[model samples]
Target: MAKAIMVQGTMSNAGKSLIVAGLCRIFKQDGYRVAPFKAQNMALNSFITKEGLEMGRAQVVQAEAAGIEPSVLMNPVLLKPTNDTRSQVIINGEVSGNMSAKEYYLKKRDIVPEIQKAYQKLDSLYDIIVIEGAGSPAEINLKENDIVNMHMAKLAKAPVLLAGDIDRGGVFASLAGTMMLFDDSERAMVKGILINKFRGDKTILQPGLDMLEELIHVPAIGVIPYLSVDIDDEDSLTERFEKKGAVGMIDIAVIRLPRISNFTDFNVLEYMPGVTLRYVKTVEELRQPDLIILPGTKNTMEDLLWIRQNGLEASILKHAALGTPIFGVCGGYQMLGTELSDPYGVEAGGTISGMGLLPAKTIFEKEKTRTRVKGRFHSQITGLLSELSGIELEGYEIHMGQTRPIDHQIACLAVLDEISGQQSEEYAGMCDHHIYGSYIHGIFDGEGAAQALVSALLKAKGLDCEEISSVNMRDYKEQQYDLLAKGIRENIDMDQVYQILEKGV
Candidate 1:
């Protein structure tokens, strides 16, 4: 069996995913065949692998760092929250069914075999596997059915390195509290500890570090500084919505919905030099920006209601009336329609009204559309749109609702089935209202698409700006990992960490 080490966090959003990714890159750079493993991931944020298998996007990023293609084995089980009470379950990259939290918790024991299989397969292929645990292992109520934290470490016989977020304060309590919560045998699996997201003056933390080592009986492995990287987070809690000094030459406001799904799509904009991307969570916070974005949502109706309740609907309408360019993607697209209908209750139970910005109606269907799409930018706005004509864009679609444009001209932006060469205004520019929506996510990855959209918005606002290219995510991630590795090498006990890796659990 290949040597393995588990990165378990003291709590959720303690930088476990990103650290695992950096470790994967570091191991790969050292000429070892490496892979990323997560026994379970619960998030609405997911991605389709090259093999068309659905999995958590965090593991996908880690796999990329490891120089390996993403597969179902990387994330054996995924749970996408559909509502407060219900979640859609994905076993081995396939949707199994919807289950309540209690139901799923009780039934998780049945899936241990599947988790074991994924681990065994990756162990056979890789020289080392970097495992990431979900949330914290110290949840007392969840300890009995914990397949992701200690149980996974035991299953793979992997020693653990517990990570604590010092930036959040209470680092000592988090570290010491976690250790105290674990049973004797389970606690033994933890060989060392790594402190993450430290801001300044490492010497200041020496006393705390000494105390943690003494209390936990584990050596301090690393003190990682907080590094600013534009990688996507797995859950909405850690999602970055605002940027400091991002009031660039051109400004864009992304309407942050309650159940926002693909906010990561705008991560590309943060690194784009000429643009400032802001996520507006409230109507009062909405400003007269150059462009307004309505991002995708997991529950369009519920979020639409939230928008209305929070006065965002009126704010968006007021902005649109001022000739503000509004763009919607996926569920956001569905909201642009006259009405949103979920008769089958595919997403949430019942029908709800929308902002009616576009002359279209959305119907939630039974079957989920999960496929990568290819399309060309329409040049219908000849004077300005001509510059964008023939621009190619590629993205994946994982939406359940379909929108039908009331007007034919508004449907010119998209060709749902590009192979058939059929054009539909519904997929593209729906109206002269400067409001557009699409089912595609990650559309800004393309240089042409990002430039064209920004140019149009800038032109509409009569602001002069140069066209900047979209971000190169893989290169960006590699750079972040390299920096993290450098920080770890300078601050961490590399000899002790390597010893833990070399020794079996």
Candidate 2:
């Protein structure tokens, strides 16, 4: 069995995922095989594995930091919320069914075996496993069925490092209050504490840290400074959506759907100099730009209705009329079609009119399309993005609908040469005039794809592409992981962390 350590947060979004990722990178750098584990993850952001199965993207990011290919064993249970009270449950990367909060709570015991199996598999393979806990463990109302926090720590025989976010305020109270709520056995499992996201000098915070250690009887591990590393978060609560539009040489606007999923598809564009990618939720925010994007959504039909009601749909149509170069991916691609029909209740079980930017139509299906594909842009793709012609792209697809051209004039945007390890030339996506849409997520992450698109947008704006530069996202992410690991190593006590791992509860 492998040695393990758990990172449990004082609250949701307390930086558990990032801490786990940074520790994974540090361990890998120290010449030990490491992996990340989350008993369950609830988020709209997901990734499809090589086996055409879906898992949470948080674990995928940690896997990248660890320099390992992502696998389902890292995350055994995934819950994509359909509404405030209901979620689509996925076990072992396959859809189990839809269940409400109460329904899932009653059946939580059945999921323990799956979690145990996944953890055992990872334990057998890696020298160390860095486990991340969701939300706080002190929710007395929910602790009866607790499966992610203290329960997970005990299951893996892991010592806990409870982290509190000082930036959110009440770090000391939250830390102490959490300890007060824990049972004697649960409190015994906690070996250390970490005060995260501190923006001030540690010398000023030492008094509070010392007081916290006295109250909880747990050693204060470290005070991690607030960092500005570029990495994708797992959920919509990410601060990326709050960014005010910046004045750039080329402005790109993405419609911020209420249930937007996989917005990371456009994150690489943020790194391209002279390019500004902004998420616009209202018509007033949708400024005139070089490119307009419709990003993926978990519920396309309902989100489209949101656009219609909020007047963003009219604004987008107005932009498309003037040839502002509209682009979309996955559910966003469906929104660009003439119409969307959901006959199987997969989404809304009704028909809805689309943005009509392209001559395509979509139908929601019960069967989801999940696959990793390799393809290239059509050699003769038209409009401002024609520079993307003949460029190779590799990405995965995860959607619950099928789109087809409504008219013969709609040109296929790309031809997929391989899907899920099988060789097949399949026509995918559509391109009509300056409007481009594809079913592939991370379409621009491939080498040269983002560069060409940005260069094209720059050229259309009468600017020199040589003035701005972009690096491959893979290399960029590696640099970010190193920065994160460096921050963790310099601030956190690695020697104490190692002892905690060895002296498991």
Candidate 3:
């Protein structure tokens, strides 16, 4: 059986996920088999497993830190919000149904059996389990049927480390208020209190920490400094979107849809030298750029309407006509087509006009298309990204629609050599002049794909390509995990953490 320790936060984006990942890395470094578990997660960013199961990306990062393969068992129940009021419920990596906020709240407890099954399976296989909680346990109005915070800790018999974000201010009040709201059972499960994202002198902060511990009767475990490491974020709440960098030698603009998912797809480009990647939400932000990318979103129709109504559609069309390269992925790919038809009412029920950048038509389906594939760009790809021709790439597909060609001018972008590791002949992506679209989420992460695109852009501007440089994404990710583990070791007391795990409630 695995010993469990839980990390709960006073609010969202309190660094709970990052801390769990750090613990996973620490346990892995100590030669113990470890895994991350989150019984329920609500996020737009998600990943597909080798088995074609969908899970939250936060768990995927922790799994990577543990030096283990990402599995659906890490996140058994995923709630992908389609709108403010509703979310698509996925259980064990498969879509169960769409339910409104109230509907899910009323029925979430019904999924407890599945959560237990997943936790038990991981317990049998690993020596330690690092669990993460969502939002706050102190939501007074939503605590009765709570299955993610206090309820989860009790279920796993996990000792909890309650963390409050001092960088957000009100750390003392938030931590004390959270503890004050916790009933006796819930308060007893918390082994320690942590002040996360501390930026200033520890000497000045020590008195407050001491006062917090004395008030809550829980030891101040550690004051974790603001982490500088780069890792995949959980959802749109990520600070990455607020980044506003002046245009570099090579400027890349990504349309920040209200429901953007997997914007991490562009994280690689941010690391390239002289490459400025910016998320543009308004027409003013969508100023002329060397490259324009329309990223994936949870709701294609609604987000497309947003761009259309907000005049970004006109700006993007102007750029497209001027021969600037435009790329789209998944939902963005669907929006680039000439028309989007939802006969099954999978999305908003209707036939809507697409951006008409690509000679393709999309039809939403009842069942999602999920698969992992290895492939290469087709020989016929032309124009700006012609440099990507025949270059190998690997990514997973997770969408609810299929695009069909509308004309001979459009050519297949890539040929899938393998599907889920089986030799097969299947095609993905399409190219029409300077416009390109694909269902593959991590298309840019392919070996040399980003470089090829950057090289072409530089050549078009007649700029010297000598300084064009980028990191190998796989190696970059490994270094980030090590940095996070090192930060935890320096700022956090791992010895006490081990004792808390061993002496679980």
Candidate 4:
């Protein structure tokens, strides 16, 4: 191994992902080429790599911070849950198949060699590799076959920094408890402990940090404060839509349906100047928004039913009646049609009624259409976008349904010409329209599109708002990463960390 460090959380969601990202950025700033690795990641939120491989968007964000193109090697095993008991196992960007919790645990050991291979490949190219472990490393039952936490750390011969979430309270208990559960060899791999998400005074945490270090006989590496970094969330829990506080400017509401997928699409818009993204839990909340966005779902039928049960379906009709700009992507797009027919039962059994926003229908197929597409703009939505009426925009498609027009309704308003960059109007709602729907995700990645859309929503609300510069995700990620890297260097005992990475644990 070149040089490495593993960030193992005391529990899941203890800011491990952010730590890895910060380390990756810091390493890069120190003139060391760094790569982020996670042996396994389970999340519905994902990203399409430059090579057109689908991986967890968390690692992708880290990769962007490191100024590197994302690849499946960054995350060797991805478990995207289709339901509670079952998940789609993506090994190296290709779906191996669906497996139950019991089934996957039994078979995970077989894929250990593949994980090692990916790690070695990354280690070879980078001067340092920062590893992010999944969940808690102290799960005694899972420790036997654990390929993601301590087991992988041992395999990689990397030093580990155990992190605990201070914001959740029990910072001491979580760290001490996790340490107590580990065996001697696993315990030896741990270099020190770090407290994450500390709010208010650092002086207040100093006494707690001193006690933790004394008890564990490990150095307290750093105390990280709560930071509002503008980055895409890894899973449903970190979702901004689940956030409280009503939207400040535009009454932007998202239908908080079950099985929501790829919500990172709205992160940029949510962070834009004078835009408030709200998650609508009830029909009343749904009806009040200036714009309604139906997010992508893993199980379309299940979420569609959730929409109806929550009374969002009727609220959507009411909003549309008032000329609310409704937008949907992929599964959301499928829901906007007249009906969702899964005759072969790919998603669920039989058919379900859609919101009927657009005059269209969707048919679920077994063969999933997964590819990077460049969409050509067709319809005119704003004056700023008029010049872009025929511009090709890059995005991806990861859906199992095909939509067709009903009663002269268009399938996709934007037709992309990949070769010439020429765009023509094919359907009506793929890119931008008052009541729009499209199979393409991340349509806002287009230049000026995010600000334009935000500007449009603000206009609809009749509020004065300034359009900030287009959110260059790649650039913004790098900048934030640089800041984080600086933080880690100044706070962490880098000399000690480097020594551990050099020598096997």
Which candidate gets the maximum lDDT versus the true structure? 3
Clash list (residue pairs), candidate 3 = none
Candidate 1 residue pairs in clash (backbone atoms < 3 Å): 410-425, 410-430, 411-424, 411-425, 411-426, 412-425, 413-428, 414-428
Ranking by lDDT: 3, 2, 1, 4
Q: Give candidate 2's whole-model lDDT.
A: 0.91
User: Between candidates 2 and 3, which one is better according to lDDT?
Assistant: 3
Give the per-residue lDDT digits (tens) of candidate 3, residues 481-500. 99999998888888898889
| 31-78: candidate 2 lDDT, tens digit per residue | 999999999999999999999999999999999999999999999999
**Which ranges of candidate 2 are over 4 A from the true structure?**
none
TM-score: the better of candidates 1 and 4: 1
Model 1 gets an lDDT of 0.80
For candidate 1, what's the RMSD? 2.8
Query: Which stretches of model 4 miss by more than 4 angstroms?
Result: 379-392, 407-411, 419-433, 461-469
lDDT (Cα, tens digit) per residue for candidate 4, span 441-461 = 777777767766776666555
TM-score of 3: 0.99
Collision count for each candidate, in order = 8, 0, 0, 5
Candidate 2, backbone clash total? 0
lDDT: worst 10-residue window of model 3: 464-473
